[model samples]
Target: MSADEHITQRNSSVSGNDTKGSTEYQTGGIHDFKTQPNESCSFTTLKSNTDEEAAIPLMVGDVHLAEAQELWSTVRDKAVKLRMDRSGLGSQPPMTVHQMFMATVQKFGEYPALRVKKDRTWVTLTYNEYYQHSRAAAKSFMKLGLERFHSVGILGFNSPEWFIADVGCILAGGLSTGIYTTNSPEACQYVADDCKANVLVVENNKQLTKILQVRDQLSYLKAIVQYKGELEQKLANVYTWAEFMKLGENVPDAKLDALINSQSANECCTLIYTSGTTGSPKGVMLSHDNITWTASAAGHMIKLKMAEEEVVSYLPLSHVAAQINDMWISMRIAGVTSFAEPDALKGSLGNTLREVRPTRFLGVPRVWEKMQEAMKAVGKNSSVMKRIISDWAKVIGLQASYNTMNGVSSAPWGFTLANILVFNNVRKALGLDRCRACYTGAAPITKDTLEYFMSLYIPIFELYGMSESTGPHTMSWAEGHRIMSCGKVLNGCKTKIDKPDADGNGEICFWGRHVFMGYLNMPEKTENALDADAWLHSGDLGKHDKDDFLFITGRIKELIITAGGENVPPIPIENALKEKVSIISNVMLVGDKKKFLSMLVTLKCNADDNGDPTDDLTPQVVEFCQQCGVVASKVSEVINKKEPAIYKAIQEGIDHVNAKATSNVQRVQKWTILPQDFSISGGELGPTMKLKRPVVNKMYQEEINKFYSE
Candidate 1:
């Protein structure tokens, strides 16, 4: 029998007796639903008999044989559309991360696999070189006595070596755990100790310093491997990149291949730590099957063409989005993955984008926002004719965007003209002319921001998922784009709304092969996230449209209940306020169990031409402040004091927004100007730039109380 046939036969036996009422079959805590045996086999489902008469007895509960067959056919069609071929006729079944890497190397050994910037020079690595170097690293790990299921911590910015080290650990039959480069020593130690990592990989001396600070706390850590920079201290078990690779020179490739073959899809491959917006970070265990499935499904969704697709890797590799896009998906499709210079990304991502002109770009909302700001800054100084042309082009582009979002087939003549004369140039200037697909996730993006990019002929698909869901549960597919929705659920994934309210908003739940295994060493949390029925409760409140597109409203835990017994979703209101007020940096709606809603607002400061902080406020900036009734002479003063002018300006802005509120309880009754903006360093914003509401509420309890007291 073929491998696929054998897998089906094995699953049929493991499925046990067909329980009449059971909706799912449990095997080692993972549920596999029953499908028609003739249909393509899925790792997520069990095959049944194809004969109509014989299959009748296998139907669950009231499901008729015909109905079951029809349901299976529908699912099979969706999988086929997603290019998920389990029979391996046209496409191969999902492979583990290590297997995928090796397969890519075998097929595209001479093709450029990775590009990195080193001291103003671009360095390229072929698929073969990447494979050889990673194998060497894996051998070195084995030489260091690292065995199967052992954990290794990778802490650094995105780099080519980072990918090598990550895949090396997997090839050695070990779990790779990523630590955010921005994490403090305490946070680093927590992750390393919790995962019981035996080896720690650091990028440079700075990262090495963090490890040294918490070295004594990580009793399980045996070795430190530095990929860059000279070691400052002669500590035991310390090995530089050159030294580490040297340890594996005598080791055989057969040894690494044996270890890779020993790994199973069901075993844990990587431990991704959650951003911990609410509390301490928990290691989310994602099995090889979970990752490979996600990579395959997501790659299919985007329709990435092999050898032609390119992506810039800049986001924290610790984040699942970056890991999946830059690491897994790139490997899955044999695409080029470029590593942006860490320091350059903060101030000059545009330059890097121009240099790479990547075909596929994935960024968070902040990146899009910064690009918009830069464009606006240029427009502010442009000639009158240019401004007029730009504005007219945007009007045409907006109509086209609106038509696309509503599923219209044809665009007006003006859209074509604008695309040729204005939008196309704008795209080229932003280095997005070659970009075929652009995505934004990790946090909520405002509709205004999404539309703005859409107007520039760059459609930004807003996706929704968490660390527990591998990467993406729902994404705006190019064929059926939606303006504000998170698009339809991916193939092989099932979604349902639990306890929907009057507006049809409810906690979003998911059941699929891409759902993570569990939280490491946190069974209680895992049990809470994954129920007995196998549905993963997302804790996020959302509503699905008539077309089945999902729209996330807000976090269930962040929902505010007023003293007047009115429930308010703060995200929409906050998003609206941000759209209306440009100078507002951040706004937090606060009124939980209170008589009325209020907010804490922060102001954006003006910067000089060199992007340095400046005390001088431009005429436009001063005019905006004045329009809101603020009387600050300098931009810096807006955050320096609680002046009457600032309060009046804030109140004016609030009153303007309140006029559009649907209910009295949703309107802001009071407001305050925070002395500073919420930041990641301050513990008010998560790594993804999402506001940590609980942390913010606790830090400003006294200020919040004063607002309520009045």
Candidate 2:
């Protein structure tokens, strides 16, 4: 087969490294950047020398820091201007999702589209290639007689077909459903039955088996299309991916036109089944316009213009976060967005990364925390070579933290010396040297994690948003982030405080075109979410400074109501604890409707940064506990001493919160603080990382009862 023939013919605009013409732009599998040629033209590397700050005088080149920043600045200005212009178009004006996607693709067609490389061989489906795939997939869906509002399911991890299936469904006027790869027989059955999809696309044997198990339960499924090699797990009545493409290639062009003509901007494009925090998952219906406009607005903030550059995408499709960054942004901006190859996210991430050299990467805070932990692990390890690397990393971290904190990202000559001596090897190993910017959301990340990334020259700016808002609200686009705030509101997005506690923080309501039309069949929910004035009642408490940067405090429902009717934001205390110590993982403030403010503490620190506690831990964890002035229990020396510093802070916070309240609201009683960390898999926190209070209180009924009981 010819080199081009080896490439997967999926959406061209969807992948980040799919350029026109093969030039070793693809790889066979993970750990093979040494083989592929870059599709994007050579942008000069940013240079580094010893004057910046380093143990050894080292010179590093090809990063192109100033050039990258300049490009981003121009894009940012354009995004802001376009958003302001569109702001006048009204909150609910309509346009097709396909139109938004195509417009962007036309703009960035020359850039590499999608880069998927494994082991040795690599394939990039460029913008033109991606476009061909979408057109064909849409045509095939039309030939299959799918009607608008009908449902189609795509089940797998991040991949090219994931977007192909999604776009095909939407372009054919059908609603798309995404299933988590981790779904069990019952979960698969539940989603299939609930969404009532007519066609389902499976990645391979594992996900296909899930469909097979629930085949009896699904009444609406008429077609099961497989995207895998068909080498594993036999199945019947299934259309191979190649056959599906053939159907499209053979279809008359007139029918393809009809498919596009049939689609409406305001119609439901995707039925995103939210990974529910409570109860069974519900399908959050987002219109093409809802998501398209959302992408339009969000794209502007991150400068996701359909420019000639690469963006890395490895987020899960089941959630709104990935859908927006990977699909919606690609659809609206028109650039090559790469997917992390299969289950080999970390490995594939490194390989594909070298191939694509993406400018922007949208990640969850957990990923950032993991990166930070990995660095610290390497730095603090006993290995002689690792320790040497760690010493250099400490220098890089210090410089990065200083720059990120001061917002002076331009490096002096000293930091230049450090990069060559230290940061280059780390950057190459992490495959992050090519990254221009990284946006982290979904949950709160330690400032340390953010600084650690920025120090390595990958600025991982954090943001906050929700599914109802179509994605982000407050995003840290620029440098100099206040230690307290998430970042400023994106351009054209507005915020207001409904009611503030003694602190300026209140339920953060948003007003913008990005806010969705409303909840799909639940009118009451729709009404509650979109208030009379059209401002989205975000239900999240936050405060913004004069500069418009937003600082999220806590959830309104989550505000721990003290015994004296004193309202307290638990997140501040929880977050403050995270910044202050190492051994503590999660700290939940209790004492709502109780005499005094108490907290339940969960331990096992490395869940985010460190892997399993059994596999790895810092020796300093024990020593750091002592330095923080925490003492192990007089009764049990084994208990982590770090627990008390957090416990003491919670007690002190009670006093701080009470100072603003009346006499009745003053805090005065005992506090119960435990020594265990809450977990998501173990059912301590929700997937979004919020404390499952009932779970915490139930599991530690003894600890909780000690303070409140007579």
Candidate 3:
């Protein structure tokens, strides 16, 4: 036979039933089944590129792959080699994403890997089925002309298709990029253009419109696939999910196998765009090693058990935190992940949580805060006797939680009774009854929110890291965690406080395999983040406690400098003020280049159907006002009338916070209540609800100037 004919014959050897067959998509909801242990399904094993491969692409988009190789090799040669005995980097050899997935499938082929709601039924996909679908998707991507080192931008919420597309992209030797569902058409274009996306997979026609609006500008975009709803327009190059999945049915298995085998652990496989609180989003390039290694190490740190963890995936997958929790960590430990409803943040999340009863839960600070507010509202409406009982139970619960956190062996009196009477019911109501661990991160969480949850016997631990570190560097867990600390560093990771002050607080730096392969196409930024020693310099300011617990103080960029050149961290003061003032919802301290610190405060108010803050106060705030003898129902009434009781309470709270300040400069000399609360729609907050200080400054520039002018 001729050489070309021989290669073609070899590629087509695998039968259609073996390579292209798919599990029947089930309708309605099916509950999770308990299959016998040792029940397993077959998974294909691909050739490992053990030796250096010459076929690996030299360039990915505008990034030179060799540059990343040199950078990580230096760290591997220096720190990794020297700390071989102590650090985790030395213990495990590097592996690609394919290897990690194979390992998981081998151990948990029959275990449920994903659960999606269809009508009222919850349908599940086993690990083996998940792998098979991803492979089929990979073939389709290859059939669509995806090239090596190119990208597939998945723009959607968390779904089965999202997971499949992401894994499929990586399997086909292309980069997987997630675009925030909230991104505008222009923003979508920027990411698509930056990643040189070969295909864009959107959740619905709404997102499809975004890509279509900018499609003319995206030179590299080859195909568009909508995972939900029918295409509004039957344009050329646009395909439905069904059509897209069928494109590669005729493609040979050997075609995808070749690309998978040519992959390396050191090369970038995914891009996580920073939410860009400080500026425009930058693509954070994470290598295969970064994802697989961090998944294993962090999973172990949190004590995730194989097939035992059940988690809700609702947060924006574009953020590294959600991606790690919903995708990587679950994949690593062979856990079941259920996708939350599309309106999760809009209030459907509670219903999903109640149904799933996840064994673990992760929420941003805002989510926890909202839950706290909802619970408080319910408590206020309870009968007199019930309220008395709940109040007593909460006190006992809080005391017990504190004792356990402090490592004191003696349980508080009535602790078990409190757990039965109040704590268990609270957990069940919030759908966290089976949760072994509940975590909060992506922004600073107030001690008030933490203590409130502790009062309910649900202590929310915090994890700290950025997109560049591939999700988590320091984590807080159940066994060994301080109330406000971000916990100790992960086993294989190292942290350093650069140039500490008298209190030992400084910029936090990370050294680990989790550090990303630099920002794509931004060399100056890459140099700024990773110093000469290869440590990823987190712009976040933090300090270590005597017992090695990590406490994040503030960010270097967020620090406010006075005219006298004294640096002041704002969050601590803001948190303190909010705690003291029950009616206050949000506060931002402003004193940069000023004589004294001032603040812009927002009252707790009801949100309209559109989620915009209305003029009316929330129920909790109204109750607070009633207690203060104010009798106000709206924020406008309190502000326009200058209600004495309300203003007096605010003054008292400010005074209480100022009394604890170390210096006169730290005191709030002047303050004003914003007519409306800061919100994501208002452009004062990021997608994860993190405060955007720069945006806030610009929005409230006129109000801020009034304080200085006086």
> Which lDDT tens digits does candidate 3 get at residues 198-246?
9999999889988889999999999999999898889999999999999
Estimate TM-scores for all models.
0.86, 0.74, 0.88
The number of the candidate with the highest lDDT is 3
Greater-lDDT candidate between 1 and 3: 3
Better of 1 and 2 by TM-score: 1
Candidate 1 clashing pairs, residues 3+ apart or interchain: none
Name the lDDT value of residue 112 in candidate 1. 92
Residue 577 CA displacement from its true place in model 3, Å: 1.0
Q: What is the lDDT of candidate 1?
A: 0.73
RMSD of each: 8.6, 14.3, 12.2
Question: Candidate 1: which stretches are off by over 4 Å?
Answer: 1-94, 606-623, 626-636, 639-649
Error of 3 at 503 (Å): 1.2
lDDT of 1 by residue, 1-710 (tens): 11112112111111111112123211221122243322333342212222111100111111111111100111100111111222211122334677667657777789999999877888999999998888888998888877677688999988888999998888888888999987999999999998788899999998999999999999888899999878887789999988988887777888777777656554578889987766789988877767876776676655567667889998888999899989988887788998887754357678888889999899888778767776887887899999998888887788888877777888866887788888889888988889988899998888889888877768898788989888888878677668888887755566767777688877888755577777877768877887654457898988888878888988878899999888898988888888887767678999999998889886665444443335555455566667757787564587575656655656777778899999988999887777666666677877677888998999999889999786
TM-score leaderboard ranking: 3, 1, 2
Q: What's the residue-level lDDT of 221 in candidate 2?
A: 79
RMSD of 1: 8.6
- Candidate 1 TM-score, C-alpha based: 0.86
